[model samples]
Target: MTEPPQTAEPSPPSGAAPAPGPAPGVTADGGPSPQAPAAVRRRAVLAGTAVSVLLILAIVFGSRLLRDFDSALLPYAVATVFLAFGVAYRYTVWISAPGARRLFRQGWRSFFSAANFRRAPTALPRMIATYLGFQKFLGARSHARWAAHQLLFWGCLLAAAITFPLTWGWFTFTSATGSGPGYEMRIWGFEIIGFDALGFLGWLMFHGLDIAAVLVIAGAAYFLWRRMKDRGAITGQRFAYDLVPLIALVVISVTGLLLTFSSIFLHGGGYQFLAVLHMVSVVFTLIYIPFGKFFHIVQRPAAVGMQLFKYTSRRTGEGEGEVLVCRRCHEPIDTAPYVANLRGTMRDLDLGFDEWAEYCPRCKRVLRGAAYLDHVKKGFK
Candidate 1:
């Protein structure tokens, strides 16, 4: 008795392509999408890289203007250039990692926010103390590990703090009035920072470096001990992961100390050979830092950014768009794209963990424990 009213469908224009269905978890309006358009992302990455390169070049040019780029400094300059290239390549690899695009988007927004700026003064101190100073959280779990890290950390940091600027020509020795190898450009102005051009400051630099050398040696010794004696702590340790960096650090530190000692004790006799050894050691370490265990330094800043964003989001009642939460912990995990990629990877590997991909670290641990108990109970039955 009733003819249902039929809705009319609109037809596509003569040569038009059919409208594509929305991708999984993507809205028609494109809101809450985990990734932006590829073109936009590429542009953002390129722009950021360009700015960094430009800034580095400006600094180099300014340094050249401030001081002569003499033959003695030429090798260091080339090494610095290679170091910059290594950093850039490593950064590119990081940004290309799974979930990195979304993380970077959130990080960029958070970094420029006024709220983050307001919190910076207080937040920076905590970051420096907790992260840069001792890595206190790791210390809470293992004192020996923490002590080793602190030694390596501060030794590298202090050395870099002084050396980088000196290499960049930001500091020059007033006592380096002659062009010979005996008078070298120094870090921290020869006159400024309350040091006479020749005597006390040079002594301080040498002793300060010696102190760093001792710390590095102690740290390397601890690591080597752990590798040899405490095998349980490092389940799958490889030589590249454990021994190589440790050995390299030890060699670098020992050679540097030797150079210092030779200068101090031998009145710089055979200084040429010592200097060459030190230079080669430093160049190798610099080349290796971006690739190996030293990447921890780069990752630490990323961790801080993530921490700051999380803190800001909680404080401001703002949520990262399309947030996925852990099933057990109730904490936010990664965005949809990351979860999707993870699931795809698991499926490809036949891991059967597609459903568990979004679980946070704490939730994963608890769930694993529960599964173990269930397995034991069934075995007893």
Candidate 2:
């Protein structure tokens, strides 16, 4: 389960200083952390059990309700079931991955540690800004790509927030007499809501999705242009990788807009067809979420783990494990174990000529440049 080796070259010069590694005492015993106490384990097991039962009931009833509305919606019901199953399956796989379990344990311990409590106040806001609000971490030098991503991210966020609940049967709509197809959006079968209401909240409930759809279209367009027009940016990406999500988003947004148009101009005259198209596109997208780039949705918790374990580990200052520092930049890069695995992999592949893992990325780039210059000098000689 070790990470692939990063290098096969000789170790750093003996004179180089070793800096702080990952969390000190993270693996003092040279093995995984001890299992939690029985009581704690039992409580976790019970809570997980209860949640699983509720989820099963919700899926069963939710599918039944959708089926009652229209037999054609069965495809959507099936897709939902598959999506749920796929999410659970992927989570299990992630948990079983190397270092993942240990990372989870460390993250949980860090969260509950009394000394770290003071930092908690700013953590949530910072995390949201870094990972969700702005996603500044995505591209170090690519502003155009990042802008396109931000549009897609917010659009999908808005769409999912509104769509999931209704699709799950937590929300419904009731058609007015002779309205003939379109219906008033309702929450929990009690509150009558729709675009018809002449107020701010009403306008949002009805038009929020439309706005989101427009954003998705814009984002998808940018993405398509990048893939087709800007070849360098999308190098190494497969055609399907570039097209599937883009196509899916465009179809979902376009169908949604078309449905709204049919409802307003045609007085729900072709609403049935538009609804069917919208439903199919949406269901397919939902099914694709856990399996495609949308799978990033399920990795949010891991983002928190990255913050907890990687960034905050050395803060304790006790020195539990060997920390890897960039010999040139003098910046902490990773734990010894992490770099060891990478070095091992590269060595195995005969690609570790310069011991690349010994240096941080910036230093690695500098080293590569120096090597190139030396080669050029030799050629001139």
TM-score, candidate 1, is 0.67
TM-score, candidate 2, is: 0.65
Question: Pairs clashing in candidate 1?
Answer: none
Candidate 2 lDDT at 123 equals 67
Residue-level lDDT tens digits of model 2 in 112-134: 76776664556645776887778
All candidates: CA RMSD in angstroms? 13.4, 11.6
Indicate the worst ten consecutive residues by lDDT in candidate 1.
Answer: 23-32
lDDT per residue, candidate 1, 148-191, as tens digits? 98898888887787666666666665434453223454442334
Worst 10 residues of 2 by lDDT: 24-33
Scored against the true structure, residue 171 in model 2 reaches a CA lDDT of 64
Give the winner by TM-score.
1
Off by over 4 Å in 2: 1-53, 59-77, 172-196, 318-331, 335-381
